[model samples]
Target: MAAANHNTVKYGIIGVGMMGREHLINLYHLRGEGVAVVAIADPHIPSQQLALELAQSFNWPLKIFSGHQELLNSGLCDVVIVSTPNMTHYQVLMDIINHPKPHHVLVEKPLCTTVAHCKEVVNAARKRPDILVQVGLEYRYMPPVAKLFEIVKEGSLGQVKMVAIREHRFPFLVKVNNWNRFNENTGGTLVEKCCHFFDLMRLFVGANPVRVMASGAIDVNHKNEIYDGRVPDIIDNAYVIVEFENGSRGMLDLCMFAEGSKNEQEISVVGEIGKGEAFVPESIVRFGTRVAGRDAVQTLKADDDRIKYDGLHHGSSYLEHLNFLSAIRTKGEKAPAVDLQDGLISVAMGVAAQLSIEKGRFVTIEETMAEHKF
Candidate 1:
């Protein structure tokens, strides 16, 4: 492993697709903060073109590689971002951790498509405790979500009992190769998309999920579309309820076809002392105390310019990247904002919920984990 460079952190990216390009763009903006985009790897021409355009636009001296192995062999980066497809995460991450020279990794959400793969990645990461393996659960770093975390941590919302997250947005955007439209590749809608919400739920409730019950189906979008003579099997909507071990419960209401809804994403938490709600897209949060005569709603909005990057999916993504880079520069002294196990547990809830919906029974997280022999 290379010696820590406290002043600057070199970064390499694999699978320069949509999300990968977004990270590259963020890294470009973080150059002032000692972030350097040293290399990018992608097999797809379009992805490579976007990477090149970004490099040229930022005037970054970036090396382009046809494959991630080539970039890894170059030994030009201290931190690597694995923004590959959902199914490829395990293999890509394993390769990175097993490399002779260690590199800190920030992998996109769901970690991997299945429990077995997630465990494999986790075990591989454990072998090298010197390397920091952070998962991209960007929502927790979102301004409003961060504010909510503050409120909860301050005991303003004492004994949080329930969390409700609703995301009513357009159907899944077409991927570079349409790999996201299948359950096998993306781990279904819940794991692919809603893992962020699940991670938030766990954060707010402060406990692991014990039981999950869900109901959903592919009732909209892709109803008439077929690929290679096969219809898309991913669900378009779902209502999942999870009970945490602490007895706090969380609910998710998701609809993929409701694109122009009032709020793209909304989160509400109820606790013994107060109630807090957040509209993520609007960057607004409301809190009301339960004390008599002082029960009034207070509105808060994220006014930080740092979260306002152009073309990013969430304003917090920039912060997420910053957090990961800072962790790497600190030589794992500062833990990542989101650890590897948190990412795995979040996916476990999604997998359990999907199985519960399919089996028409309440599924325990233990059952889901055991089923996968995790």
Candidate 2:
């Protein structure tokens, strides 16, 4: 990667929602180090005003616009963070990739709503080799996950044989109730929420999933409607199976309406020599084997040292932003940690898992790609 051109790395945010607000705070810190957020655009006036207030607090001149096109055409930003809803990722990404600005794009998770749209954004990025397109799978940037990848690749765990994950949380009815309740906007429960876990599964195994099968039901949320000849269309609880190209297998259990259930985004990877588990929020990794081939498990503790940050998380959004900026300076020769292609595959896996559940059969990632005509 080329050296970061800090002075020239200006960013514009296209969405001012929750993730957008986080990015704005990240850019605020970046601005103190010569990089800046020059423009912001969102459909909601309240969002725009919030962004302006945040920017103004830093005494930075941030221009706010009503639409993304205005922000792009203003030439105030060299990169655009497309943090809009999943349905709009395709259009907004295409606009950024096609613009004369050819600005680098940092899109939020899952890339797009469907495989076809994922392909569209990726193909456009491929055509413009000068601009970089990165997907925000922030978990990949987390320190614990990074360490997990290193340990797996370093053979500390020996050949990873099986991976299992559980993500159970309360229904997401509090925010965007209608859009999330239905599959029309959210792209089914698995794709809407669990793509991040899918991405991590791929990353930990260091292989793409070749096949997937899943079973799920709207047992708690929207169950009555689904049983009454009305399709709830969204899954609330699911059991997913994934087989990797290298013969490793994974099982995932996801539930959205489990009573008294806490958010469980934990993964356990069983390997030939040992097993490893990651507790995401706590940033803890436990690895070790049983005593002398006994059935008991052990925990290999990490150093537990923390890295210093300049007003950013150790797994900082600003660091990811800096990485994107570096990729742009390198003219696509430098690989982004999470690129458009990775984003597509992540979404594809989610799509396949959902399809497997709905069709009551195994689904190949290839079949999902074929449906997209890719």
Candidate 3:
């Protein structure tokens, strides 16, 4: 393992798609804070064009590679961000880990398309403790979500009993390659889109999921359209119930066709002594404790600036990159907010829910892990 540049942490980006470009923009904002974008890898022409344009606009010298291997071999960066398609995460990450020179990685959410691959990534990451492998579960860094976590940490929410997260949003946007429309590639809608909620549930409840029951179908999105004579098989709506090992439970109500809904996402948690709720797109949180009286409720709002990031997601995207760079600068002393194990468990919960939906029965996380058997 090589030491990081004392004054600057160089970064390499793999897959210059939508998420990749968002990271580039965020990195551009952090140029003065000891962060530098040194290299990018993506074979897509539009992605290449955007990367080149961004580099030129910043007036920073950058190396371009058609694939991740060339960037890794170049040894131009101390860290790498893997934002490739979900199915490609495992290979990209493993490559980073196996590189002759140590390279820390920040891989996008779900880790990979299956539980086994996630476990493999986790194990490989564990072997090299000097290298940092952070997952892009950016929701935890969102201001409102961070406030909710702060409330939970305050111990007012004693022995959390239940958590509910609802997302009523437009159907999945078409990706550069339409990779998101198929379960084989995206690891099902639950794993691809709902993993953030599941990760939050695990954090609030302080336990891993024990059992899951789910039901859903392709109610609207892609039902009337065919891609090369095949209707998309991804589900558009779902209700998932998860039981945690600590006796707490979680529920997720997802509707992909509800683009006109007033709130895009609402999350609520109830514990023995207090309760908290958050409306994501609105950037507001309402919380109350039994000690404060039955009818008392307090409202909190994230800073107005938190919603200003140039993307559909919250401003936490920039914060996530900031935290990752800070962690690298500290040489593993300042740990990532979301580490590899946290990423893997979140994916496990989603995979379990998807399996439960298919089998029409309660599926245990243990069962899913056992079946994968990595």
Best by TM-score: 1
**For residues 1-374, could you state the per-residue lDDT of candidate 3 as single tens digits?**
33345577888899999889888888888877867888999999898898889888988788999999999999888889999999999899998998888899999998988988988888888889879989999888777778888888888677799999999999998888687888989999999999999999998899899999999998878878677677778998999999998899999999999989888889898999999988887889889998996579889886435343545567788888878888887889999989988898899899998998888999889988875442
For residue 64, give model 3's deviation from the true position in Å.
1.1
Q: In model 2, which range of ten residues has the least summed lDDT?
A: 303-312
In candidate 3, stretches whose alpha carbon ends up further than 4 angstroms from where it belongs are: 1-6, 291-294, 304-310, 372-374
Candidates 1 and 3 compared: the better one by TM-score is 1
lDDT of each: 0.87, 0.77, 0.87
Q: How close to the true structure is residue 267 of candidate 2, measured as C-alpha lDDT?
A: 77
Query: What lDDT, from 0 to 1, does candidate 1 have?
Result: 0.87
* lDDT tens digits, residue span 1-374, model 1: 33367657888999899999998888887878887888999999899988989888898888999888889999998889999999899888988988998888889998988877887788888889989999999889878888888888888889999999999999988897788888989999999999999999999999999999999999988888777787899999999999999999999999999978988889999999899898867889888888832548899886457753745656677888878777776778999989989988988999998888889999998887774442
TM-score of each: 0.96, 0.87, 0.95
Q: Give the Cα error of residue 270 in candidate 1, in Å.
A: 0.1
Clash pairs (backbone) in predicted model 1: none
Residue pairs in clash, model 2: 287-300
